[model samples]
Target: MRLLLVEDDHMIGEAVQELLRAESHAVDWVPDGNQADAALLAQRYDLVLLDLGLPGRDGLQVLRALRARHDRTPVLITTARDAVAQRVQGLDAGADDYLLKPYDLDELLARIRALARRAGGHSDEAYACGEVWLNPVTRQATLRGQPVQLSGREWAVLLPLLARPGAVLSRAQLEDKLYGWGEEISSNAVEVYIHGLRKKLGADVITTVRGLGYMLACQPAP
Candidate 1:
């Protein structure tokens, strides 16, 4: 999904951004609290990966502002080892998840997905649509009992559609959940990934709507 990453360490920031981009997420990376606050105030994003130690406004201040405004956007705080207490404070301040410094990219992405799954607090991690099964935690997909390995972006592309089952997601709507900062997107990148998913998941599984976006052939389990 499109996320705002507020981190200062250029190396870590760049590495994390690249990793998330490889997952096909559109990310907007900003350093310091001012840029982060402005972005939070002026725009909407699927999720926010916030670093607790920030210059100017401080991460807690930013979280407080967001909560005070009842923004309710899902925020995942990045904290340090000694600051375990800050994790609780961050959550209490309105963060949806927490990531300690020196975390695995896999863990970070999983944390992001877990929080986004709570966008409306829909916490079902395993989704089944027809013969397709997706594991958000592992980023694994299986169709008709066959394993499918998806690139990070491809997973980013497919998860939202799977999340909504049969709901139709327009290109722009889906794009909102598919990208991160400094990640290059092809005009047809989404299509390319979707096409690949269709091939692997079976053409009958994903249907296109002419000029519109695609939809998965899934119905929620009762």
Candidate 2:
């Protein structure tokens, strides 16, 4: 998944971005509210990690503008403010979730997974396709009860396919899930990852749509 991180604190921003990347998410980090606002307007992201305290504009202000513009992208606010009133204000301003500063990293990741699941219209953390099972929260995959390891990029490509079993995802759509700002984009990167996923998950599990892109092949149960 691709995420936008709005944080001014250098230490916090670096740590959070590193963690998200390690989880195989494409993340774009901005240091201030203005840049964050611009990025939000310009790019497509699966989720937004927002900080309440920001320069040039407050996080609530950005949230208000986003809502006013009818941008429904989920926003999770990370702030030091712990007052009930502040939390209410953030939620009322369109923030989807709130995480106080000094929170545990595990909790933060858990919240992210929850939001992603909701956004994807999934009722649970795991996505299943026939005999294959994928746990988005743990970033784990299994085939016919056997565990399968996937590289970060490979997982990125597979998630979208698994989200909607037989639906085809355009190459551009899959590419968006794999690359973010400052990362090199290879023309054949999506194809390479698809190949790797097929090799690991079994060739019959993924299908090429010829001119369209790719889809997960629908298979019958034994």
Candidate 3:
């Protein structure tokens, strides 16, 4: 998923950003509230990891502003403020989840997965298209009940397609999912990954919409 990380501390932000990238998520990192607001305005993200004590504008203010504009992008607050009132304030200000500072990285990742699943309206951890099944949290894929290997880029490309089967995602949209800000994008990067996915999961597992783009094919392979 493409995510925006709003964090101030260099160490923490760098660590978290690398961790998310290792998990195959495309992340854009900003250090303060103003930058966060700007990023939000300029781009669409699957989720936002917000830090409450922010420079320029407060995190709560940023979140309130996002909600005020009726942007429903999920915000997960990660802050050092441990007070119950503070947590409540963050939630009331429109944070979808809150994580205290110095929390376990595993827990953080789990929360992200949970939020993604909820945002996609999926109650189950696994997503299916025809004979293919993907477990996002586990980063595992199976085809016809057998395990299949997929590269990190392949996993990234397949995720959004599985999240909303049958919905057409344009090449630009898929590229957005595969890359973060400032990352170089090749002309046919999406096609390369799509071709790789089809080779592993079966050609019929994904359908090309010609001029439109691509979508998960739910029909059984012939």
Best by lDDT: 3
Q: What are the lDDT figures for the candidates, one per model? A: 0.80, 0.91, 0.91
Per model, state how many residue pairs clash: 13, 0, 0
Tens-digit per-residue lDDT, 1-222, candidate 3? 899999999999999999988887889999999999999999999999999999999999999999999999999999999999999999998899999998899999999999999998989898887788889889889988999999998999888888777799999999988888888989999999999998888888888999999999884233
For candidate 2, which ten residues in a row score worst on lDDT? Answer: 213-222
Best by TM-score: 3
The sequence of per-residue lDDT tens digits that candidate 1 reaches over residues 1-222 is 788889989998899888877777778899899899999988798888899788988988998998899898889888674465767777888888887888888789788877877784577777777777888766778877789887776787787887787788888777677754444557887788888887777777777877788888766545
Point out where model 1 deviates above 4 Å.
Answer: 81-85, 104-106, 120-124
TM-score of each: 0.85, 0.94, 0.95
For model 2, residues 1-222, the per-residue Cα lDDT tens digits are: 899999999999999999988888899999888999999889988999999899999999999999999999999999999999999999999999999998899999999999989988887789888988889888788999999999988988998888888898999999888877999999899999988988998898899999999998964332
Global lDDT of model 2: 0.91
The true-versus-predicted C-alpha distance at residue 137 of model 1, in Å, is: 1.7
Residue 2 in candidate 1 has what lDDT?
80
Query: Which window of 10 residues has the lowest lDDT sum in candidate 3?
Result: 213-222
- Pairs in clash, predicted candidate 3: none
